[model samples]
Structures are given as structure tokens and as C-alpha cells.
Target: STYRLLSLVLVEGARVQPHYIADTSRRSTLLELRTMHHIRQAVAALSPEGAARIAPTRIVSVHDIAPAPEITARRNRLTRRAYLGGQYDWLARFAAQFDIPALELCIHVDDKAHAFISEHVEQVEGEYWQLRKELVDTDLSLFRYFRFPVLHLTKLEMDRLARQHGFHEIMQKTWFCHSPWRGRPCGICNPCVYTAEEGMAHRLRPLARLSYTLLPVLSVVREARRFVRRVVKR
Candidate 1:
């Protein structure tokens, strides 16, 4: 249902619509489509060829739901409440097009992410926490329209359950990319940076892993160089 966490906690026999918005990004590639393609392939391969357990991932067009592409996160960026609301509302309409009961959004909240959000509490003006919180609150309207509840599951818990089911390595097979080079992570983009910080090293390559692992040192060095320039100017 998302380009984020790979949902391995699929309910057996439940009609799950693993849908994605086939919206083109600034990078010129439909990264969601590519990622979901890999996910669908992995999901199908996991449970056996042509498994009836999980439904195929759906690719709903952005133009089909929203009036224009300007409302997307890529264009509008989730700064304003109205922009964020528009984004979620578009998704709600997309879901409403289907006769499904409700949408289940898989949210992966880790200690690192929680700490990051807490640290940025003072900078709530267009921060990820603020915008995400506002958009998440719209789940109520989504549920009311669909007449069902949207489930938010943690990645840690899902991993635990995956281990129980003997398929804890599905994430390694999943894909998350906004800007990819030769189908590999660019290792410097926002999604790649976050992917590194979130401790998915096993899924990423050496360069991507190093980009995140060395980010702190790089930041400090950059600041030190800037200070030296300032002193020289003085």
C-alpha cells in the first residue's frame, strides 16, 4: 500500500489491494511503479507462483484521481496543511473508486524515527512530523467513507511476525527509490538518505550504506570548512 515498508504481515485469505499511485516524479521515473513492481514480484514469488493469498499490486493513475499533478507531494511538498490534505484526499478518492472495505496503511515507527521526530518538535513548521501527523489524521474520513478501519502496523512488529512465518527477509527483496542510477540507489537522495538512517544496510549497497554511516562526520567537516572560510574572510 506504500512505497515505504514492505508489508510481509499480509492477512491470509484477505482481499488486500496493494495499490500505488503511478505518478511521475521530478526524477522522471515512476519510482513507485518500479518499486511496487518488485514488491509484487517478490510477494508472488514468496508464497508460491500465482498465490491467491495476496492480491496483485494496483497502479492507479494520478491524473485519474486528482485534477492535476501539482497536488502531489513531489510538486507541492507537504508544507501547507491544505496541500497535505489535498494529497490524502486524492488518495481517499482513489481508494473510494474501488469497492474494498477499507485501506490499511502500514506505518513503520522505529526508535530512531521517533527520536528524530522528537528532536524536531520545535521545528514543526513544515517538518515531516507535522505534515505526516496532519495527513494521518485524515484516516478518520477515509474510514468513514469506506465504512472500515485502516490498520497501522509497526515494522518491528511486522518483522517479528515475519520471523514467526519464516519469511523475515522480504525487505531485502523490496525496492525503495526516488532517484536510481542503473536501477540502484543514487545514495544521496532523500529516500536513499532516510533508507540508510533507518538501518536497512543489508538491503543497500556499500556506497549507500557509507553515505548514511558517514553523514555525521561529513556534516561536521562541512561546517568546519565553512568556519575556516569565514575566518579567512575576516
Candidate 2:
């Protein structure tokens, strides 16, 4: 029922903004609706016990929740406006739909801090550190309305969190093996690097294998671009 409702809303949203929906690599709103319908049908075919065991007791939607208003009103806020807007809608709908409480899982990785190699590095000097610090200090109100737990998880902790969210490491490994570079998972991007590192640490060998194979390909493409630029100058 939740899936059906969400599909209807997504379809409506897409109808309202077809061009905006069409521009992204994510499934077209129509396709998403179809996919959800297919999933629901498959689940419905399962035995009651099987369905109950597999189905989430509480519907969970993980998002990057925004900081509190006090934090957002201040200077150097890292949370974007869209983050806040999405949180509002997600929370409102979640409250309305579920008879039992829904869990608004907010996952925050300290991206700016993660970007810095070391404190002494010029790339992450005073301003960068200060900005990251401000972001870290900001109050995130994820716990206010739902069962929110702040996890300052390292790469390893993130894997544990994923498992807690019903994704087994083996399943995750299989997913990475099959569709390793889908969408923005550019094999050379920071996210790819981090994912690779985490998977290896957790002994998700398949994910590590995919990352190793693709990262070199991405690096070669990047180098080829640099070479092309240099040649074009002549």
C-alpha cells in the first residue's frame, strides 16, 4: 500500500514536472511507478510468514537531513536548501502514512573533512577546516520526531549500518559487481574510492574487484582528457 501510494505521488510529481524528471538518469517517474508495482506484485505472491519476515516493520527512508534552523540561519551552513525541503516533505508524508512510527534515517558523512588528506595539507588549510568544523558543530534535528540515531560511522561502521538497514554484505557485493558504475558512481570519484575501501575492509571481495577493475579505466580516461587538452594547445 505504501509503495502504491509513493508510486502514485511520484507519477503525479512527474506529470507536474515532466521535463525536470526526464532530465535525470534516475528512472523516469513512470518507470519508477512500474517498478514499484512489479515489486509489490512479487511480494504479494509470497506466503504470509515469508512476507512478514522480509517486510520492514517500520518503513525507513534514509536521507541527508538538514541542520536545525538555528544552525541554518548562521553563516557557513553546509546543508543545502533542497535538503531541508526534502526533509519537510519526507517527514510530513511519513507521519501521515504509517500507523506505527516511521524512522527517518539521516546519514551524514563528513565529506569536507573526508576530502582532506591531512591537517598540514595546503588544500585543506584554515578556511576549509573552519567550514568543516562549523558543519560538524551544527545541530541536526533528525532525532526529534523519529527514532533517530546519529552514527559517526567510519567506512567500516557504514557497512555495519547498511547491514542493519537489511542489506547484507554479500548482496551489496553482488550489486556492485553487476552495476559497478551506475549513475554518479564514476569509478574514479571520491565516493567510488570510499566504497572500494569499505568493501575491502569488510571482505566484500566482489565489490573490491569491481572497483579495482574500473578505477584504472576511469583514470585512463581522465589522463586521456589531459593529453587531449595538451595536444589541442599546440
TM-score of each: 0.57, 0.34
lDDT of 1 by residue, 1-234 (tens): 232223323433344556666666446256555555665667667765334545666677677873424333332443342323234556656656664454543324542223222322222233112323343343233322322111223445555666675556655555566677767776666666756565555666887777767777888999999999999999
Q: In candidate 1, how many Å is residue 3 off? A: 11
Error of 2 at 217 (Å): 6.7
For model 1 the TM-score comes to 0.57
Worst window of 10 by summed lDDT in candidate 1: 143-152
Residues 58-169 of candidate 2 have per-residue lDDT tens digits of 3243332333444334222323422233333335334334423433232324333222212312223221211223233333322223322222335455556445543333
User: lDDT of all predictions, in order shown?
Assistant: 0.50, 0.35
What is the alpha-carbon lDDT of model 2 when measured against the actual structure? 0.35
Error in Å for residue 127 of model 1: 29
